[model samples]
Target: MIKIADITNIEERKAIENIIRNYREDSGTVISLLQDIQGHYNYLPAYILQLLSRELKIPLSKIYSVATFYAQFSFNEKGKHIITVCDGTACHVKGGPLLYDYLINQLGIHGGETTPDKIFSIEIVRCLGCCAISPVMIVDDELYGNLNMQKISKILSKIRKEEMIQEGSK
Candidate 1:
């Protein structure tokens, strides 16, 4: 719920502004701008996207395509915790599907869907490059190996507790 103008990171904001200013009429540059925005916000804030469209004179549809086409781009506000399950060839053969189902059912959301309370979003990745930990899942960049449904619940509760503490502090 923060305004992009409220962003305190001057350099990051400048990079986005520069990209838009340099390529106001170029659709190609729109893709790059969206990428940069996503990198800054974890998810592209809707207001910023509108700002870019108006400033760049690009159609909103085009901007949406660029945002949705890339797996990295997320339109919805991402949760404080991002849970990514790896389902590459190695992980798939090693019970990845079950883990995926577990996450979906437990979180009450499908892959790419944020939780109702916005505490977590579950994402499925093709590979995490850790075959040794075939059924590996990452929660906020922290990798967990040899996961089971029980462990997922434990980790989620721990994360929710931590988020609550952080929210209280703010």
Candidate 2:
């Protein structure tokens, strides 16, 4: 077994330890603890979940269920850029599927798969509630609307360039 001494981040370790201590006896608090961990790390790592489960004596299945059920929680390692395509009725009627396919084909990965370089993760959402902007996509929270095939290509190119620039700066 790996020793806790390997955990170097004192604050982070304390935060997690505190959560576990405060909610040790509360089974329902597992979800909240997971959320707090997610706030620290963009996505929940399986090992961390297992650690919490062991500490709290919660079943792994129950932890997995909550993670899968919540839309806010992500099991996949997220990319620097998150691409969300809206496919609600309004968006769907306006060729959302076509746009989604274009993105997947171009990225060479389906929704939830991060690129090999971990620069992007494609996501499909039922709606953004912006029916007016049917066939829309959001890149890192910036919404683009009224998309056509050509427009999508351009937008993707722009995203790639932006990612490249960010990487170069770092």
Q: Using lDDT as the measure, which candidate wins?
A: 2
Assess every candidate by TM-score: 0.68, 0.71
Model 1 TM-score is: 0.68
Worst 10 residues of 2 by lDDT: 1-10
Residue 55 local lDDT, model 2: 72
- Model 2 stretches astray by more than 4 angstroms: 1-3, 7-29, 54-62
Pick the TM-score winner.
Answer: 2
Per-residue accuracy of model 2 over 1-170 as CA lDDT, tens digit each:
32345567898678777777767656447678878778777689887788777777789899999899998998878887789888799999999998888889998989878898887888888889888968888988798899889988898798789878988999
lDDT of 1: 0.81
Candidate 2: lDDT of 53?
74
- lDDT of each candidate versus the true structure: 0.81, 0.82
Candidate 2 residue-wise lDDT at 61:
95
Cα lDDT for residue 145, model 1?
Answer: 88
In angstroms, how far off is 140's CA in candidate 1? Answer: 2.2
lDDT per residue as tens, model 1, 17-65: 7767656556457667877677667789787787777766688899998
**Candidate 1 Cα misplacement greater than 4 A, ranges:** 1-32, 39-41, 56-69
Q: How many steric overlaps does candidate 2 have? A: 0
